[model samples]
Target: MAVRPDPIPAAQAAGTSLEEELAAVAASSLDQLRPRFRALFRVPVPDCLSRDMVARLIVHRLQEQRLGKLDRSLAEQVDRLGRGQESRRRFKAGTVLVREHDGVMHEVMVVPDGFLWNGGTFASLSIIAKRITGTSWNGPRFFGLRPVLKKHAPEAAVVVDDADA
Candidate 1:
């Protein structure tokens, strides 16, 4: 088995001050970046970035190292919102969401405005879901879809307690 060397170079790891670290990252070359990326992320660095991107990445890593890594949920939400894309989701307009209630099959069409169920256009899936079930329900959850998890939604933001605020 091949043993990996200490991820950070000895010079950088030897208690170098933050100012020195920032300067080093600013001056870093591709050759210098591989081990630094490994040291920080504990993973091999991907080769796809341009030289300029690596420098920008180094600055970002340095900030994280000094302050703290972003919260995992927050980071994921930012990543989702940043791309401005739905990334080819499995369902879209004209797709059908179906549910069975009390031996009856209910089909809902994915419309641009909302779901179409029982020949009526409703504003939200939840409303259609309730109409089908005769009870309040989370529309997406009722249809066997992956519920929009609180962490997955930036709009379902994390709220601190009044005391925490």
Candidate 2:
């Protein structure tokens, strides 16, 4: 008979710091992680998942337990962003966006007021994209921040002859 490892609650009884627990999880091997994963998740670790993935999931769960999970609205927003359902993309200050257009490389830095490009501050990415391409362009799409939308071709009309009917 094989011995079962202690669950996360029992493991936490050791009173280790969150960072220490996280580090331990990061250093643990696949075999070591399986029982911990089972204990924390209350389910068998899927065989299809790699060791790295299992470790990440375990870490996330630990963090959630230690420092509460995201609120419902914030979690929903994150899920929407991940699924590309959110239209507006927010960039933190100091973020740098780069794009290549017509053999020229353009770099834009996100600022508190707006965006900085070529020593000038602009209100939006569209303005920067227009300046670069000499045409109106969706800034996020131009800079590859957003996915390209494909235009569907119109369906052909089918005609039926009364004689055939």
Candidate 3:
């Protein structure tokens, strides 16, 4: 079998800044992008992909290499959304979500384990919502993470007199 060429050039391997590499990718032509795409993705460039798309994929890979990939849970959530599946709202650790109910403002902080509310660490938002509302409620909906579905009204029946008919 023939040997595959290195995806990253020597200049890039030798500590090139992300901006410089991205600029180079942006300036490269289709022919130039093919090998880079193959190297980065470990597969031949698809015939359907445009030069801009290839460049973007390469840029994303490069960024992932330098910065790091998305968190596993976040990536799964994104995939679920992409597949048109329902997914729970995800918040980064230390993010504060706020909602107002009964003229009182309530704040919840996202923690690594779960959520922080009212000086207690809870596993789910629904519990906090229940504490605040005194009734069982979907935590995400109560906190505005999920949309509240509206009930549809029934169609009105028509009444016609025999003479009119």
The whole-model lDDT of each prediction reads 0.66, 0.77, 0.77
What order do candidates take by TM-score, descending? 3, 2, 1
lDDT of 3 by residue, 86-157 (tens): 997456777777777777778788788898888999999899989988999878777766656756421221
Residue-by-residue lDDT tens digits, candidate 1, 19-42: 777777667677677778766667
Q: Is candidate 1 or candidate 3 better by TM-score?
A: 3
Q: How far in Å is the alpha carbon of 53 misplaced in model 3?
A: 0.5
The best-first sequence of candidates by lDDT reads 2, 3, 1
Candidate 2 per-residue lDDT, tens place, 1-165, comes to 996653333356676888888888878888888889988999999999998999999999989999999998889888988997964667777777767666776778888899899999999989998998888987877777765775642122122222211
The TM-score obtained by model 1 is 0.41
Compare candidates 2 and 3 on lDDT and give the better one. Answer: 2
lDDT, model 3 = 0.77
Q: List the residue pairs that clash in candidate 2.
A: none
Q: Give the winner by lDDT: 1 or 3.
A: 3
Clashes of 2: 0
Residue 84 alpha-carbon offset, candidate 1, angstroms: 19
Instruction: Please give the distance, in angstroms, between residue 32's alpha carbon in candidate 2 and its true position after superposition.
Output: 0.2
CA displacement after TM-score superposition, residue 27 of candidate 1 (Å):
13
